[model samples]
Target: MKNVYIETYGCALNKADTFIMETLLEKEGYKFVEKPEDADIIILNTCVVRLETEERMKQRIKELNKFSSNKKFIVAGCMSSAEPATVLSIAPNASLVGPQAVERILEVIKSSERKIILDGDKASVTPRLFEGKIAIIPLADGCAGNCSFCITKLARRKLRSYPLREIVESAKYAVLNGAKEIELTGQDTAAYGLDLGGTIRLPDVVSKVAEIDGDFMIRIGMMTPEQAMRILDDLIEVLKNPKVYKFIHLPVQSGDDRVLKLMNRKYTVDEYRQIVTEIRNKIPFVNITTDIIIGHPGEDEEAFNNTILLMKELRFERVHLAMYSIRPNTKSASLPQIPDSIKKKRMHIANKVYEDVAYSVHNEYVGTISRVITTELGRKGSVIGRTINYIPVVIKNENAQLGKWYNVKITEASFYDLRGVLV
Candidate 1:
């Protein structure tokens, strides 16, 4: 196909997959189009994170199937590999490619008959998701965690850390390409470098990139508690660099020890909090964001209350809350599931608790002047800027320029963000 149209979904890893597809097709003289109506090849990079997400992906696939008679349509990404039968049942005529098989996109595009390439890891493809604004570097693929509820582990099979030099070079390439923000991401960032000999770890990677001689800032991605504990001292050292954003994302999942044990999480609540305490003691301005699953199986009422208490004690800058929904073939799926009503109730309570703490923390920013980097345009005609600590500040003016720093006076605050006006 001469023209390709790709719609990416899911996490940064999937976006990086689309970037690989774009880079490969461009080398063969293929043109990318904005809309599917104007393209010869249509590809939908699907996500299967939640049952609801799969349903949404199915709807999108059906809409794109109408173009299959004229266009060479394909279904790619996590769902292609994890739920191959489900995808084929919906669009049997379309070619299928897995998340790991991104490099073979051109092969599927060239074949006339239905092609399916969903075997294993294709380490040859190094994703450079530089969309002119930010450059996302996938330091590795897969993870070393054995969490009971994660279906992503099935889609992305193993821990394959890319070479340290190559990963560092990708960061250099991004900065040279005018990207102001460099994100070091992987399935489990703290677990990086274990597949490579034990010499290099994530701290080594971040330190090398920080020395790349650029005005860019680095943001490290999510780290499982067990792995983050392994490299806390070293991680803290690299994060001290001015090039790194004063932020950390640690997905503790649940706060109760009973729930954590049933979920097969390696770290305890105290262990997770110690990591948070250390980061706060060393870098007080660092914003810590976390994830919490409200209603996992085996979470008793006492366990649920413990989580609420933890939230009040920690008061994370942002809490990504989710209701536990069982995914097929996962360890937790076989266990007794909490009722949907219970999960929904827990999610609502957790959200209310989250908003209470979030608003209180954000109110501290009001009536203060701070410098922020204008990053993206908000959906409401304002420009979104972020402080050094990564707290989003909405400069309520449409004419603000991006990629530049502006001094703003904080006028108001919400649980979501800070609203400011140019000083």
Candidate 2:
């Protein structure tokens, strides 16, 4: 059998797409290889979220070109759909496939001539039974937002939520196959069912999935503040389900209303604050995670300070910090840009503030005992588990079994993770 090597980049949605592609290709008798050197076919499932990521994807495609003379190379994912010219410029002979065209990966692989397949929305593909203990399920393919700094919207345009029944069935399949954690991901999970009608159906989807007979914990993905506000009450109600993880990934891009308006984010800083406050009030001790983009265009010193102040007030358990980089064809790219030095300085300041808050939050968990389920093996020969709220805890015990629950006593704490011992 011919060997295929696939390397993926970007978020959980992209990773889920890779898993689907692998399952489809494997069924066609293609053996997956870890290293590109050992494979007859190599696929780069790319990401073009930021300028740096696009450059990395181009560089990887260029490097893979050397092996193109001997092996068949395929370029797929966001880069393939949004920036095919760039991919072709680096690797002319590589077959191109889009994020929506994942189901056609095998057809592209078997073709003798170079192919460019970038059509269809394969959002309904109930991902084959994942071999891992954690199953990442894509609830939808695209988002409904038009954030000015976002290039992903260009690639994955419009919202296309998967059928609720299909998603629930996939979750059931995954749990029956021994998955302990089910992560429902999308471009904007809160915008689910917007395209179908006026009503938001994310709460309904989560409720149905929670009904599935399983011991798995469900992790709801990132949601924009505006979208979350529409169904905030229902969403919180669904989150209260014991099967759902109390982790909230809300990307309040900027803390200043001016910057938020410049970025085309619908909600203001006050609106975002209210959402955070409400969620916290309803679900006390919930692991509230947020994303922050520092140095976005038109962010002044006062604006940046506002973000810092908000971070201090929120005390987010985790912060997905990103430095604003120019993405081609994005509205923010055409705006007056921030200096790299200034952006770097702001990034350093934000990171330091975030680290302080994070360390303090994690420190609270130290000396506390919590029941956790071992999910995966950690780096440095430790077993990684997560509390009911999705707080990552690393256990030093070698005897810890994957997908098994244990009472762990928190012994140590860090800015990012907690070290614990099995009780």
Q: Residue 76: error of model 2 in Å?
A: 0.4
TM-score of 1: 0.96
**Candidate 1, superposed: residue stretches over 4 Å from native:** 120-122
lDDT at 155, model 2: 79
Candidate 2 C-alpha lDDT tens digits along 77-160: 999998888889888899999888887888898899999987665467758657569999888888878999998887787677
Provide TM-scores for the models: 0.96, 0.97
Error of 1 at 292 (Å): 0.5
Per-residue CA lDDT of model 1 for 70-162, tens digit only, reads 999899988888888888888889899987778898889999888999755536666554785577888777888878998888788888777
- Top of the candidates by TM-score: 2
Estimate the overall C-alpha local distance difference test score of candidate 1.
0.87
